[model samples]
Target: MKSVLQIGKKILLVLMIIAVIIAGTRSIGMGMNIRTPKNGINVSFYVDINGSNQWINIYGKDIDNPVLLYLHGGPGSATSPIDYSFTRKWSDVYTVVTWDQRNVGKSFDKKNAADKITKDIMLADGKAMTEYIMKYMGKKKITLLGHSWGSMFGANLVLEYPQYYDAFIGTGQCVDIAENEERLYEEAKKWTEGDEEGKVLLSKWSPDKCDDTQALLARSEIMNRYGYGMMKDGRDYNIVATILFNPNYLVKDYISYVKNIETSMEPYMDFFAHGLYECSLLGKYDYKVPYYNINGDMDYQTNYEMACEYFEKVNAPDKKMYVMKGGTHGLLESRSEEFSGYVHDIAKRMASMK
Candidate 1:
């Protein structure tokens, strides 16, 4: 009996060891399977911007493919962590680059005061980063893709330096900020006409009356809760889970992702609240490069109508607007394949133009 008990204990110990090994493999395995193709290029590094370090990841199956620099949304939000989900496929065709804009994500600086960061500074950083990427890849020009707040930044960059880009793609494009906000506010009110909680939350802030960023933040929270933002058909996607499981992010990077949002929100809120309205290029109608606006028909965040309006008015050497049916602000995630195909088609057209 004593020998049998000892044998059982040993077996239990072996099982525990096996379990540990499996768990360890799974945790690290998240990124292990990710590999660049032979002759492909994959690089993750930091670039200096105004004496600060900004993080960027560039990956592609072929180094010779056209470069596609993606500008993530969120004046304070970073998309680098989730790039693997969708952008990886894009990398197969184009050298896809994702950057954590200053004051956000891995690039967040606790020592950098909020007052020092502004819209112009961020734009300058983007331009500098583009120049660096061009030089690093031995490419004179690259394609620019921006989403949400990124669209706003990319629009400015393409307008100012059309010579540096082969094409411009704006997803969830922001045309007029004040008008979009007003439309959002009205839509929120309309959607909540039958719901008491939503109305109460929305009533605390009026789009025209409330210029406070906190109020806008509150309004957005309420709207998102009602599935007016990214959620569609009562289906909820866990973005936090997506970020946590990102293989490229370490424990410290994850912590910074959360902390940076809080640290940068106040400064960024003011900029987003006012800058989009005051400096919006709603009336500007001409661009120097091939421009494409791919938008979700159901997107209320940036107002799809405004994007269509801007696309109609804007004149480019080559221009097109593709609307995804029943799509929302999360169109890139929901319809990544379709979006990628559009991008490839546009790239082909761009190559032919050259």
Candidate 2:
């Protein structure tokens, strides 16, 4: 007996209520809070290190576990977005920390001036972060893990402050930049064979021409074209998705990272434009503490062969080169479980050291 207008009004009200409920639920999800494990530690924080504002995430199943400071690759690439997939399992034995170094990813600020972030600045920031973690965790030394550019940074770090760590491991390790580009050029040509367009691209690139940023980017295109770039299993788009959808990353974090990721390395452009002085760890193989390198067989980015060669020259109290078969530069994420298996062995013993 109700009029059509009356019923329609009621339906509209119900629909509006349902829409609000849905929107509220999603907004809450966007800001999901960290749930720490019982008796363990899980925190995401921001700290100023040597004038650079940075972000850090730490997690563990047991607070007493050995601290493991994971230095992500890229003078600009921040891997904390996909870090949980590979580093979570080790939490049982190691308190893992992932950080976004200065002017990159979660640490990037549009208002900040990063043009002065030189090698000395970066190293100073690294030491400050290490000290911060050690002091906060009430530990004397922490295990160090560096990937790609992190391997470059961390390799120099532990060498300079060998007494501060129990062990240091470099995955997707990068050695000499000049030689790295030389070998990458040859391999890129081998894969791009018979493609005229690819040929034209490679002709403009060479080891010595690395200072030209365009050529360097083209090298990435060539590597990505043949599944020899980030990973043999996936492309860069997939990794970007991981970063955007990461539960630990807020909407603001994702926006900042996407906006500045490509330009993140500009701070070190001047120094890197000349030579490998700050970028290469080749020939400097003396380690006061244990040192290790892990590489994927298909990692053309850092060139696995070069990692093996450098591993051979490294002399340390303990050292090993772990090969992840058929893996790529991104083997850490692609082969997370397998990579964790090896790291577990290392973490367990390292955690118990007197």
Candidate 3:
């Protein structure tokens, strides 16, 4: 019996050691792999943008391909870590780029960023970043694909600096954040009907909770539970699980990705309270370049009905809106491969024009 016990302990210790090694390998992204094709580019590094060290990831099959920059959602939601899911195949057609916006994700710096996240500063950052990308890649103009909060930024950026862009693409478009929240609150209350326990959770939401991330996330959680969340089909979208397979993200990047959502967005609370209500772009987007929007009808985050209504009023040389059936807020992450094809089709046409 004593001899058998000793052998069991030795086996358990070896298994634990092996497990730790495997996990560490995955954490540093060594378990995953990326093969950059001939003449292709796949690299990530820090770049100077607007007096700050902003991080960018660039990948494509051919450097000569048209530049396509993807701006993530969230005033603080950085998507660069998990961007490989949709962008792995994009290099064949586009020189895809993803930037961790200033004071967000890998670009976050507590010492330099003290309440500097504002409309004016972000626009300046966008302009400088656009110039940097154009110069670095030797391109005259590039295309923009903005999602959610990014759509708002992209709209303002192109409208202000039309010379730097060849075309614009928007998904999970942010037309009116104030209107979106109100619509969500009302519908959320309706979902609590005839159910006392549900009402308990619904009571946590109010107009006052708009600037509170924990409260807002709680309300959003309720919305997601009732099928109006990230994905329309009620499939759980787990970024934590998804990140394990992506080679682009180091463990530190993953930590930054999660922590920075709250840290980077803190400065925006005041803007949300004071400036968001009157900030609807219903009729303001008379873009100088061709524009396209890919939206999901089931998206309550941006309010699908309002987006379509606003889309009807947009003016540009070329504009089209493709509404996804039974889609949710994150069409890019949820239906990555299928909908990314939609993006490729749009990008290819724009490249041909250039």
Best by lDDT: 1
Q: Which residue ranges in model 2 land beyond 4 Å of their true spot? A: 1-33, 211-213, 235-247, 351-354
lDDT tens digits, residue span 1-354, model 2? 578889999999999999898657645643443568898998988988876688998889899988999988766667766776577778888899989888777888666645566677778888999999999999999989998878888888998888788899899998877788778888877877999888877877777765578887787778877877776665323564445445577767667677787667676464566534565787798988888777898888888999898888888988877888888888777777788887887765554555
Task: State every prediction's TM-score relative to the real structure.
Answer: 0.87, 0.85, 0.88
lDDT of 1 at 131: 94
Q: Output the lDDT of residue 305, model 1.
A: 88
The residue pairs in collision within model 1 are: none
Tens-place lDDT per residue, model 1, 238-326, is 46555645666877787777766777666677677566565587777789988898998888888998899889889999899988888
Candidate 3 C-alpha lDDT tens digits along 89-177:
56678899998888777888777656656778878989999999999999999999898888888988898899999888988888877
lDDT of each: 0.80, 0.79, 0.79
Minimum summed lDDT over a 10-residue window in model 3 is located at: 232-241
Error of 1 at 54 (Å): 0.2
Better of 1 and 2 by TM-score: 1
Q: Estimate the Cα RMSD of every predicted model relative to the unseen true structure.
A: 4.2, 4.6, 3.1
